[model samples]
Target: MYSGLMSTPERLIESTRELLWERGYVGTSPKAIQQHAGAGQGSMYHHFTGKPDLALAAIRRTAEQMRATAEAVLGGTGPAYARIEAYVLRERDVLKGCPVGRLTMDPDVIADDELRAPVTETLDWLRERLAAIVEEGCAQGEFTPGLDPQQVASTVVATVQGGYVLARSAGSPAAFDTAVRGLLALLAAARTPASAPAAS
Candidate 1:
């Protein structure tokens, strides 16, 4: 359910996003979208070409939202390690799993290049952004020298995505919390000691 103030098209897109997260592309029927959105079949057709078209819009919106959320913490003022820590520790629906990450598992979404672009692009962007942060951390001596920025970035992304799967599997948020704490511990170990020499 959505706000009454939202336009029909907005409601349709929001509904589709929720359905897509709840059910994969194949499981999310047009009728279900219309019913959830409180829009008539005619209204749905009038705003978008079809399910694919509407789904693409929903996916794009979700991707954009994800990027915005990450940027809020990653782009904030702080040492690089703290910023990265903030990102991982941010609140989320651990049991429900990631909204964008879930799409990666959807066969229908993965098969279509058009549908998959946003998902892939969003993930790629996240990795790149995190790499930049890690690189900055290395420069600031927040992390030890010789740590590969790109690799560390990928690891962070993998941990969060993998943590979601683990949490959902066990039906407990504790699994996700354990994964995050473990990563933080590893990162803390990687921190450069004040007495350590800078890379020549």
Candidate 2:
């Protein structure tokens, strides 16, 4: 009677991704995924042995999406400061910690190496991508001469993550805005003349 006819496996995986985004690893269940996907238990079992299996697939999908997003934000066609600012200023729902970052708070995810790998990889890619941009800015005389790209990149990532935590904790977006503005100011300072000393 199901006429729309998306493949059962695809539907299950997609449903798992959504549930993971909404409730996280421990909060998600096979029944929830099945109900969301409109698939039967037998179909889900045929596709995945259990929640962990489904979660692994979802985690990989999330990691891939994060990488693609970084590439889009950090690559090509602008001054490095402008590009970094663009990346940071992209609209986001601050109260919902980054989908990938939220996994770090889930105990079940931290306990499972397979699950943790994708989360770690996604964050690493983001930090390295941002660092590369900062390094480019330094080389172009657009940023402080001795700015530590790795440290700055780490702070940028941490600020975004911490902003989410603060927003979720405080039940408001004000903290998120405060954190973002502070970061923008730091980046602006990096672009000042002292940051880009004239050649000897």
**Candidate number achieving the greatest lDDT relative to the actual structure:** 1
What lDDT tens digits, residue by residue, belong to model 2 across residues 1-200?
Answer: 23467788878877887788789877788888889989999989998888889889988998898788868978977878777777777788777778898889888998999999999989998999999988988898888679999999999999988999988999998988788779988888879585543679
1-200 in candidate 1: lDDT tens per residue?
A: 68879999999999999999999899899999999999999999999999999999999999999999999999987888888889999999999999999999999999999999999999999999999998988888778889999998999999999999999999999999999889988887788786233579
Model 2 ranges with Cα > 4 A deviation: 1-5, 194-200
What is the alpha-carbon lDDT of model 1 when measured against the actual structure?
0.94
lDDT of 2 at 175: 88
Number of clashing pairs, model 2?
Answer: 0
In order, the Cα lDDT scores of the candidates are 0.94, 0.85
Score every model by TM-score: 0.96, 0.90
Best by TM-score: 1
